[model samples]
Structure formats: structure tokens, C-alpha cells
Target: MPESFHKPVRRPSSMFDTIFGGHDPADTARVAHSTAHALLSRVREDPEAEVVERLVAFTAEHGIDTIASLWSQAPARSLPGALWRIYLLQLMVHEDANTSSIIYERGRHELASADPIVAGAPTPAGPDEMVALADAILRGVFDGDFAVALNRAASFSRVEASGATHLADDYELTEPERSTALTTKALRLSTFAADLDAAAAHWRAGTLT
Candidate 1:
């Protein structure tokens, strides 16, 4: 196991308790801690090949919804929690990829071309395509630099946000409030990209939370 994963870590209460009150946070934490450690250790052995293989196999065998159930309630600072966040971001994009593609197509024309580290791969055109790209990017976290994957996601977010802005204003009956909301979304995603940069640095330093 990575030294960081092995160190003492705080266990936080489940965020989903209010909605899903039956599950016990303590039991959930215990399972998550072990599962996260095992998976992290496996990835460490051969990050490039093993990480993707293990994740793919695990999900294929056990199902993503099963994993996501636990992930939804995991504490944010824990390893499982971080993994959950990463997975959730990808899932959101993938689940609605077609809609996202349409929006991306509309705004991408006005924006500067994405940087290689940002959106190096081809823009996804549908749910299946986006899921493939999302998987690749997530796989890249262990196969390559985690920061680059995060930056790419951030870039993806920015592009979508820009599209939303355009969509909000495309009509003759443009809604200033809606446009402003989209602008806010763009700014927030930009900050998330920066945070991902810091997270990458932390990961390198063995201090990621």
C-alpha cells in the first residue's frame, strides 16, 4: 500500500445519511478504507497497465452501480472519497454525453483550441464516445500523470460551460440571468482545474486528501 494510504486518516460521517438513513457510516468507512487501500496498492505495483486493468475488471465483475453506492456516501477526504469524486465527474459527463456533445459543438467554434494536456484526444460525439474518453482519462490517472487528466477534465468543463453560455444567449430573447449563471459555471470549473493542479502536487508529495 502507498505510505499515504497507510497513514492515520480521519474518518468522517457519511454525507448520504439523511437520505439513506439505514446504512451505518462506521461499517461503510471500514469497508471503504480496506477497499480503497487494496485498489491503491494494486495500482502502485504497475500503474500504467495494472491500474486500468484492475479497475476495469473490478467494475465489470462487481458493477459500477454497486461501487457508486458506497462511493456516494464516502467521506470527502478519504481515499475512497477522492476516488468517488473522480468517478462521479466522469459518470456525469458520460451519462449525458450526447447532450454535452451538442452543446460542445455549438461553443467550441468560438473558443481557442484546447491544449494537448487539456483535450488532447478527439472530442466525443455521443454517450458511448464520451464514456470511452472518460475511461481513458481516468485510466490516465494511474497510467500517466494524474494532473494532466484533471486538467483535461477541467478543460472539458470549461468547454461545456462556454456552450451553456452561448445556448443561453443564442435566442433573440436572451436571458441575462441565465447567461450569468453559465459564466459562473465556467469560472467555477476554472477554479476546479487549478484545484486539480494542487491535488496533483499533493499526490506527488504523498499528501493528497
Candidate 2:
């Protein structure tokens, strides 16, 4: 498991519960939490609807507010929570980076390791594609294409295990260095999201407010 999602042995409630698990009841980040909970619940409650239906509902009903709200109310100093915030925020902006074809292949391998969802689920873009997409989105921010940042990251074509894929061909990694690539890819995406979040917060605080 990623350290960002560790299970502490000495907490009354899990970090998720304290930070973002159960619904907040106060209507602050409550719906955001509830939607997240419902996402999980639907996975177990009605796994069938958990796929496309739930995603549609989430995008339609709450939009990025539901996502950003989670970040806004996220525990200020929680590293794991911060990582989650970054991941969620990135998930929003990079929605287009669909790497389903590649993921279907890699996910089969990752399922036996860890993070079945991350490994099992599809990515719109592979590592390089995602990073390029992130750069484009960041550039959009500079260009004042406010909505561009909210667009899905980018789509990535399938990569072959024989090492013909973009990342495999462009970046060489030793056998022990494989995980490093995945981690690096995920972090780059997260950093782009965090940067966008920072800029938005700055604008809201400095001017909008």
C-alpha cells in the first residue's frame, strides 16, 4: 500500500474517517464525503452501478465542487490526506487521459501486487502522455483557459509488455526500478493538480473574495 494510505494502529477512527470517511453531517464537505462513501458503498452495495452510472452521477451532480470541497476541508497538515487530495484533484483534471487498453494489460499484473483499483482500473494516459497532458493543462492556466484545467488529462494508447510502449521505449528502468516509474508518473500528475489548486486558491483569496 502507498504510505499515503497507511492504516495507523493507534487511531480511534481511521485517517479516512477523521479526514474524509463518514459524511460530515454539517453540510460543509458533507456531500463530498457522502459521495465518496456512496462510491464505495455502490461498489459493494450495487457493484453493477458502481462503474459508469456512479461516475456519471458524480460528475453531473457535484462536478469539481465535490472534489475541490474534499481538498478545501482536507486536514491541513496530513501528508496522506494531502496525497489523497492531490490524487483526487488530479483525477478530476486528467479525466481524459484514458489508458484503458494499457491498464487492462498492466492491471492484470498489478492485481496480484497492490492497489487493485489503481492497477486494475484504466488510465487515460500512460506516464508520458499524462505528463505532457499535465504540461498542456498548466500552460492553459497561464493562458487563462480556466476551463482547460478542468478538462480530462489526455488519452494514452495501449503499451506492449514487450517494451514497445512509449514509457518503456523512452525511459529505461532496471527490474528493481519498475515501481519507481509508476511512482514518478503518479507524482507528476499529482504535482500538476496541486499547482493548479494553489493558483486557484490564490486567485480566490486575492481577488474573488
Candidate 3:
């Protein structure tokens, strides 16, 4: 009789494959890119789009971890970078709609006497409007000029940060320091947005090495 033997079992390719079935980094990237592209296309095509919540839900349920995992290591001008930015924008708007609205309202009021406004950005008044503006901005990032979108977002963030600082200074309310702290974050985000804009510009100029 032939010696009884067991065929060797194949090991999983990666931890991801071991846990979530067999998918490698390339598969994850492809899925992330395709998922983002498809969802983004759906959002763009809807004339009366109200898909921000849906997009947020879908990303959280399906792709956030995978995309974020790879996104952290991607170069600024790469597809993963773009997808990460889009996901972040959506998640920010979704998770902090209330804070964004507060910041927007306070900033708008503080700037009212000076006619301060983001030139092309919408003046969002509440959570819904904030979500809408964010969606539109992300849409522009994909469908139009990426740099312009980044700059527009940066302008909005600057205005909001300015307003946040003004509120922190101008008011004597309970938790006055909150606005001050938020101002710091808003300003940091503004800088990041500006940096992204510069990167996009460099990419366009073919000088971004």
C-alpha cells in the first residue's frame, strides 16, 4: 500500500486574507478604487442628490478600514490619497455636522459686519447644508479642478477658523475655551487643505516629484 500522506495546507497570503477571506493589498486597492469611483459616480449623477448620508453609511460599513489602512501610506497625489481625502471629507461632515454648523454659524455672524465669505463656497447654515456643501466640494474634487476644490475648502475652513477665534475672544460664555481649541483644529485643517491645493497645482505642472 502507498504510504498515507496528507497534502500540505496552503497558508493565507496576508492577515487580511486570513481574516476576511483571500484578498491581497492589490485586491484591496482595486476594491477601494472601484468602490469609491462607483459611489462617487452615483452621487454625481443624481441631479437632486441627497446621498451624503448613504455614502457615509456605505463607506463605514464596507470600505473605511481597508482604504484607510492603505491610505495612510499613499503618496499625496495618488489615487489612494484622493480616496482617503474623499472619505475623510465625508466622514468629517457626517460625524461632526453639528460642530461644523456651529462653526459656520458663529463664523458667519462674526464675519457679517465685514462681508466675509468664501468666494465660491456655499454658506452652510446647518448640518444638512454642511453635508450638502461637503458633498458638492467632494464632487468638484472628482469632477472638476482638484486644486480649486481644495482652495475653496481651505477658504471655507479659514473663514470658519477666524470666526471660531473671534467667538472665543468676543464671548464670555460657558466653555469659552472650546471655540479656541476648535479654532486651532480648523486652522490646522486649513493649512492641510492649502497644502493639498499646492500639491494638486504641482501635479498639474508635472513638477511634483
List residue ranges in candidate 1 displaced over 4 A: 1-34, 47-54, 57-64, 74-78, 110-117, 123-129, 171-195
- Stronger candidate by TM-score (1 vs 2): 1
lDDT of 2 at 111: 35
Instruction: Give per-residue CA lDDT, model 1, range 164-191, as digits (tens).
Output: 6677676426677766655565565455
Q: Among these predicted structures, which one has the highest TM-score?
A: 1
Candidate 2: how many backbone clashes?
13
Over 4 Å off in model 3, which ranges?
Answer: 1-60, 75-83, 109-121, 170-180
Candidate 3 least-lDDT 10 residues: 9-18
Q: What is the per-residue lDDT of model 3 for residues 47-166, given as tens digits with 9 covering 90 to 100?
A: 243454444344435544555554533444544455465556555655567776787677776665332354243555677777766666665655556566655565555556656676
Runs in model 2 with CA error above 4 Å?
A: 1-56, 70-73, 76-94, 100-104, 107-184, 188-209
lDDT of 1: 0.57
Per-residue lDDT of 185 in model 2:
48
Please report, in order, the local distance difference test score of every candidate based on alpha carbons: 0.57, 0.36, 0.55
Task: Compute the lDDT of residue 86 as modeled in candidate 2.
Answer: 34
Give the Å shift of residue 53 in candidate 2: 6.2
